[model samples]
Target: MEATLKNLWSTVELVAVAAHSDVVEQWDGQTLTRAFHWAQYCQHLFHRFHDNPTIRRVMEKQLQLVNESVSVVFPEHTAVSFSDLSRCQHLLLVGLLHNTKLPVSLLRILFDTSSPVNKEQAGYRNVTGLCSSMIECKSACKVLSPLVEVSDVGADAEVQGVLLMERLEALLSQSREPFLDSVLQGCEGAAEHFCLVIAAALLTRKTAAAQTTLEDFLLDWLLHKHSLLQHMCYTLPASLLTDLAKRHVKFREAYCNVLKKWASDMEYSISDGEWFQASTNPTVSFQKLTEHFRSLSEASPSLWEHVENQLNALKVSDGDFDVRGLSVWGDLLSEIHK
Candidate 1:
């Protein structure tokens, strides 16, 4: 298994390069068949071990790397390659539909069936473009098109919000346990990513239903408050929500409310024991704490200050603030002082 894993990753790297390189469309028929076969086999392994962190991480990383490399041109490349666009499209489709199992509804939304789109056209066009491309020429588009209901999607914000939320729930439920496993791993990375994903999904519509959905989701996040603070105590996440709030005031307040609780918990968790601790490692090193904060602060200039000012006023006004818990699990304050 280990040797196969090694060669498998090597093959993945080579396949990614081919999927992205200008040379792809020119590959001999034999080479093309082998590449597709390998990718398909890998997809099978991915599904078989969907619950295995080791397998999921490797597969997700490879697909991410492939997409990034294919979509972006390196500085070294004298010119960009769009010729392999079809091949890249094919692999990406198989990866998402077969490998990732991304919800079909959203994919359809990203690609409008009334008019088909290619990747280049989609990127330049925004969601308008993204919703237009189909796939892999394996006729996944045919399998997928019936799922879209694009013709039914209209300018109904409430309905759009409803549809979007349904898709979001599908996405969330797909790997809920796996995602929670990562969340419980002592880092805010997964929860922070989840927040961003939700924010993007919710903000696209302008409807009362959309507003209610956002409110509900934010409230639900209280369950993951500790996870939120792991990334929130710094800047980007806070700043991001602040910016998002300009369009909806509740977003700002609801987000700050969670931070306030995290701060309150931090004030007590050091001596209170483990009721609130989320990490499997109950202990946290100051170095990891500082490093995490530093990365968040650097994500945006002065973002830390803006978020801190708002949250500090909310959590520290009682004069009970403490830094000790921040170094430990479930808390988010102490790392700043040291």
Candidate 2:
């Protein structure tokens, strides 16, 4: 038994028990520092005694020690107010961000403790920025899945271009009003990045169901979620889907399916658009879309202009709305076009 881990561990047997709540809570700073010792001991014990199970148990303990230490050293990091964070809060956030080795457990603590500010949309944006900047996308998404409104299509790291896009898709599929608009730009940029990857996939002949994630997200959301038919026919219908499909012709049926669903469910009307407007300014969302499908303009002369014109014409008028840009396309012939 190494002296560093020995004094704290108390038992020679490294075959671990999940640290109890009391053990984690009461363990002082000195004991917590022994975590590295435990990790070191686990490495040595695995080789010396060839005790794999015992070492594995001890490794779990070490990770738990690190996780708990994070909660102790910087308490209430993710739970704090998103708006007007104090210097202490800034320091705490920066501390977590600085630690690249953040575990999945601590990430869960961040989301679990935090709550969205309903009336103040900025709060949601602030938190989303913080999460995206600090937390790894995959870890953040796994914790956020239960919060999603729907998700039939799963994630694909290779296809989405980046792992974050998979998380973004799960987020955008939801009917979460207060946070949806704020979160869409994250999705748009992610969608764009993945589309670029898909474009390259087209060249390599490496396309597959796994590779066509963005298309799958759109189709699955529209098909199974059912909210898209009633809510998204105008914005998500032909404009965005067409450009996405062109990159990979295989998903054209998904695009056509969205439009067809929108047509049949025309009777279900609302004076608003779906999955389009990200913020108070339509330009923000439009700019994001253009960035994502920037390939569209390159593909054809008139295509980008048409999409831009349609988006520009609409104004998010006066309403107690959860999302921005309500006045633009909600059954407006001028906005929807002939």
lDDT by residue (106-224, candidate 2, tens digit) is 44534433543222232212232334444455666567666754322322323333433344344433322212222332234464333334332232233565545544554453345
Kindly report which residue stretches of model 1 are placed more than 4 angstroms away from their true locations once superposed.
1-11, 19-25, 28-44, 52-174, 177-196, 200-258, 261-338
C-alpha TM-scores of all predictions: 0.32, 0.25
Candidate 1 per-residue lDDT, tens place, 246-268, comes to 44445545554544444334323
Best by TM-score: 1
Model 1: how far is 39 from its true place, Å?
4.3
Candidate 2's C-alpha runs over 4 A off are 1-23, 27-161, 164-239, 267-338
Clash pairs (backbone) in predicted model 1: 110-130, 110-131, 111-131, 111-132, 112-131, 117-132, 122-129, 323-334
